[model samples]
Target: MAKCPEDLLLSGCFSSVALIMIKAPAPMLIAVGMYLPFDTTFAVFVGGMLKLASDKFLIKRNADEKQKTIVENIGILVASGFIAGEALTGVLLAALVLLGIPSITSLLTGQNAFEFTGSAMGGWLSILIFGIVILGLIRIPLGALKNKVQ
Candidate 1:
């Protein structure tokens, strides 16, 4: 027989408590990541890799604690801006959809927009853009550190 939602909820609660008792790190985040879609999780994985790279970059540069803190702060601000911008853009697009404007380009050009989104080239373009964003994530903080020294 399939377990009821109450049973599942209780099981989850017990498991979480067990993990906490075991001194597990980020147990809740790990559990939530397990349930998230692959694309969402993959983005998180990429972010983790970027963070690793940033830490390595700082070590390679022999950054002082103050420099490291400055870079960390800049990185946090950049990440926050990215999150806010994505959320705002999503809200704006949803509003447009609710207003019966399906595609902004189509509204302006009287034709279907984003036809490339279904093609292989579109996939490659997405990868390229993702790479650019990743580079920005690494560079922007380090760049700020450089500017602060002058």
Candidate 2:
């Protein structure tokens, strides 16, 4: 008797469940990374790196419990705001597409001003902007510590 594709899929699902039941997360993380788009995974990787950097900075500064709590709260708030903004932007863009309306950029410029987005210079500019954002993430919380100290 030959096994069907459904049987193979079911076995895969069972194996995944077993992995989870055994408290193993590496396989799950690998599976999710493989399933998600490159940009999505890259964003997650960047976020993880930012978190690591933040932790290291805090340790190097010899932050106390109260200081660490303040920084953590500020970071969480900032991250939440970013997540909300991104979600809202995504919804707005999706609605515009569904309504057959031009994007805000096109409406403002009377054309696609982002045509250069695919260029090498545009990529560099994006990286520079992202680096600025990363710096802000690291500095904003630590800056709060400074204010509290003074």
Candidate 3:
């Protein structure tokens, strides 16, 4: 008797963990990619590539094992923070909607709900903000390692 989706366990619906363990990201990409702009997908791809490249660079660096471990731990913490921030933002936006306040999206876009990519200026601004965030992500971990070494 699951009233809400939150209460409904996958265990109850699925007979075994094997079915749950099967990830189908291709189906997800096919379903959602149609609705997203090429810029969005390209940006995601670039971010993933940067992640892979950074991982390789870190492994090849001449830092001692302890320092590398510190950097790795810092990276994990930064990534966890990013994920938590996203979740918290979603929750805050939902709370704003429940409270009848304009969510950040409508506030930023105006009453017309203008898409950020609708104009060149908006698109560039979005890119600038995204770049700044990526810079911050890289900076924080590096700063941590620097401090640990000093």
Candidate models: Cα lDDT each: 0.87, 0.82, 0.68
Compare the candidates by lDDT and give the number of the best one.
1
Tens digits of per-residue lDDT for model 2, 54-149 = 788889989888888898889878878888988999999999899776767786777877777779988999999889888887888889988997
Q: The CA-based lDDT of model 2 is what?
A: 0.82
Regions of model 3 farther than 4 Å from truth: 1-47, 104-119
Identify the leading candidate in terms of TM-score. Answer: 1
> Residue by residue across 1-150, what tens digits does model 3's lDDT show?
747664335534452344346765454454345447997677557656656765676677667778767766776687678779989998998998898866566666656464555689788888798788778667777678789878
Q: Which stretches of candidate 1 lie over 4 Å from their true place?
A: 1-4
Ten contiguous residues with the weakest lDDT in model 2: 25-34
* Stronger candidate by lDDT (1 vs 2): 1
Model 1 residue 51 CA deviation in Å: 1.4
Candidate 3 accuracy as lDDT = 0.68
The predicted structure with the larger lDDT, 2 or 3, is 2
**Model 1 poorest 10 in a row by lDDT:** 26-35
